[model samples]
Target: MQSVVEQFKQTYGRLNARSLGLLAELYTDDVLFQDPFRRLEGLGALTRYFAELYAHVETCSFTFEDEVVQSQQAVLLWTMSLRHPRLNGGQPVVVPGSTHVRFRHKIYFHRDYFDAGAMLYEHLPLIGMIVRFVKERV
Candidate 1:
């Protein structure tokens, strides 16, 4: 049997607006998912969140870079290649991020770490300039 982390990676790689059903195979009913943007509890809320996200993106894909697993917990490093019509002239933006997940059979806790500025704020027109300036100054 494949480990939960492997299943997660496979499922996540195929995820999109149409593949939102796959999330149920990877997470428990009451899973907790947290990222820089928001914290979601329950599979229903997570599905809605992904639906909204995928609806806006032209394309979004992940490249798994590395992982460290111990028992029921895993830390996965990944790069997300994203394209949105409103961001970066619809060109791909690569964002490096990581996910820490805990599972028994299906994941119940998943937290993602990534720079909000790099993913969203820095891609906006006016805000992007200000964010970039602030980042440069800091």
Candidate 2:
């Protein structure tokens, strides 16, 4: 049997609008998912969130780097390459992030850590300039 962590990586790598159904295989019915932007509870909400997210993206993919696992918890480091027509001029934006997940047969809790500015704000036109300036000054 494939470990949940490996299953998660595989499922997310191929996840898209069409592949949203795969989420059911990785997450429990009442799973809790949180990221920098929002917190979601239940698999239904998560599916809607991803649907909206993927609807606007031209392409998105993750490259898993490292993982630490113990008991029923795991932390996986990854870099996401995303392309959105409204952000970064439809070019790819690479954001480094990590996921912490707790699972039994399927993941029931998940949290993601990443720089929201790098993923969104820094990719916008006007906001991108301001964010970059602020970072440089800081």
Query: Which runs of model 1 end up more than 4 angstroms from their true locations?
Result: none
Residues 89-110 of candidate 1 have per-residue lDDT tens digits of 8899899999999999899999
Q: Number of backbone collisions per candidate, in order? A: 0, 0
- The C-alpha lDDT values of all candidates are 0.94, 0.97
Model 2, 51-137: lDDT tens digits are 999998888999999999999999999999999999999999999999999999999999999999999999999999999999999
TM-score of each: 0.97, 0.98
| Candidate number of the best lDDT | 2
Q: After superposition, how far is residue 9 of candidate 2 from its true place, in Å?
A: 0.6
Give the C-alpha miss distance for residue 88 in model 2, angstroms: 0.7
